[model samples]
Target: MSTVLAIAKRELKSYFATPIAAVFLVVFVVLCGVFTFQVGRLFDRGVADLAPFFNYLPWLFLILIPAVAMRLWAEERKSGTIELLMTLPVSPGEAVTGKWLAGTLFVALALVLTFPMWITVNILGDPDNGVILANYIAALALASVFLALGGCASAFTRNQVVALVLSVVGCFILLTAGMPLVLDAISGYVPTAIIDAVRSISALSHFTSIARGVLLVPDLVWVVSMVVFWLFATVAVISLKKAD
Candidate 1:
């Protein structure tokens, strides 16, 4: 456990040591602010709610999580540091857990930076703090799922671009599967049961429900299961690589 945390700390510090983290922070804040205030017309509507920001989280995570995850294993492999790490005394599980922890911490920090938006909504009017808090839980779960998926993709290739593209495509499909256009396009030929099943697997469906302030057990279970499954897959990939 201590070894894992050490790796996580090192990984986090490495992120801050580079300009990428700064660039990412600046862009994420600016884009999210624009979407929440300008595009959502939060000020124009005179509504004291974080509806726009929570609503935008699914899309934001689809892109942002991949960017954060792209370099995890890919960079190590690209720089030939993965082999050096493998030769260390650390176990594979420790390494994977450390990377996952670092990525999650980065997401948590980004989410925290958006606290001003919460304050803005509070000052503007009376917002449902309970529901907003629930939305944050759901958002964190969503980001975890994405991070795990990104970790799995990163393990599959040495190329960061490939990892990023694969994670983005996979996540985007899961995200949009429940949208009207996507469902309508597929529902014409698929049975109702199949379409419903597809929708049930969608990130948006679960997120939308939680954003409405309902945090059901199933939603929480789904997120945890999704992340665990991908992390296990990452371990499998690493095991295979070690065998080779």
Candidate 2:
């Protein structure tokens, strides 16, 4: 645990040192403001809820999460730091956990910056705070899943650009796995139960449900499980690469 925390601290500090972190935050804040005021037209709605904001989360995360995670392992490998990192006493699991924690913290920070939107809604109307809280919870879970997937994707390549592209494509498939288009494309031959299972495993499936203010335990469990599974897979891949 200490080893993991140490790695996490280092990774988080690295993010702050790079211009990418500042750019990411600025872009997020600006996009959120534009989406809420211009695209969503919060004033026109005259509502206290953040339904419009939450509705755009999956799409926002689909891009941002991959960008944030693109450098996790790819940059290390590109700079020959992965070998140095492997020489440390830290196990593969510790390294993966630490990086995951760091990325998750970055996502948390972005989410925190969105709190002003919450405040705006509060001042405008009496919204259900519980639902809003759930929306945030759902966002955290979705971020966790994407970051883990991105981390795993990063582990496979040394080029950050390649990592980013692969991560986004992979994450997009995960996000849209349950969408009507995807289902319709495969519904002809696949069994109903299989299609339903695919939908259940999709990131959008769980995120949209929670965003709608419906907090189901099964949905929460699926997201948590997927995050853990992907992180574990990342550790395994790193271990194998080290062995070779």
Candidate 3:
């Protein structure tokens, strides 16, 4: 546990040293403002809730999460630092978990910075704080899922650009897995059970349900399972590459 925290602290500090971190935060804040006010028409809704913000959050994360996770392993391997990293006393699991924690927490920090939206909603009118909290929970889970997938992608390639593209594509599939267009495309060939399964596993579907303040046990399980699966997969990939 100490080893994991040490690695996590190192990774977290590294992010602050890079301009990318600053740029990402700026972009996130700006996009949230634009989407909530202009694109989402938050004022037009005449509601105190941040439903519009949550509605746009997942889509924004499809791009933002991958960009943030692109270097989790790709850059290290590209610079041949993976060899040094692996040689450390840290075990593969510890290293993987530490990096995952660091990346996920970085995204969480950006989410925290959006508290002004919550404050604004409060000042404007009375809203269900419980529902707002639920949506925030959903956002964090969605971010974890995206980052885990992105971390897996980064472990597979040394080029950050390749990592970013692969991560985005993977997250996109998960995000739209349950959408009508995607489901309809495969519905003709697949059985009803498979389609139902697809929707059941979709991050978007679960996120929507939770975002609406319907925090079912299944929704929580879905998010936790996907995040763990991808994180474990990333560890396996890194281990395999080293053996090669």
Best candidate, TM-score: 3
lDDT (Cα, 0-100) at 125 in candidate 3: 96
Which segments of model 3 are wrong by more than 4 Å? none
Ranking by TM-score: 3, 2, 1
CA lDDT of each prediction against the hidden true structure: 0.87, 0.89, 0.92
Deviation (Å) of 8 in candidate 2: 0.8
Candidate 1 lDDT over 34-86, as tens digits, reads 99998887898877888888888788899989999989988888888888888
lDDT of 2 at 210: 83
Alpha-carbon runs more than 4 Å astray in model 2: none
Collision pairs in model 3:
none
Best by lDDT: 3
What is the per-residue lDDT of model 3 for residues 36-139, given as tens digits with 9 covering 90 to 100?
99999988999999988999999999999999899999988888888899999988889888998999899999999999999999999999999999999999
- Please give the TM-score that candidate 1 achieves against the real structure: 0.93
For each candidate, what TM-score against the reference?
0.93, 0.96, 0.97
In angstroms, the error of model 2 at 220 is 2.1
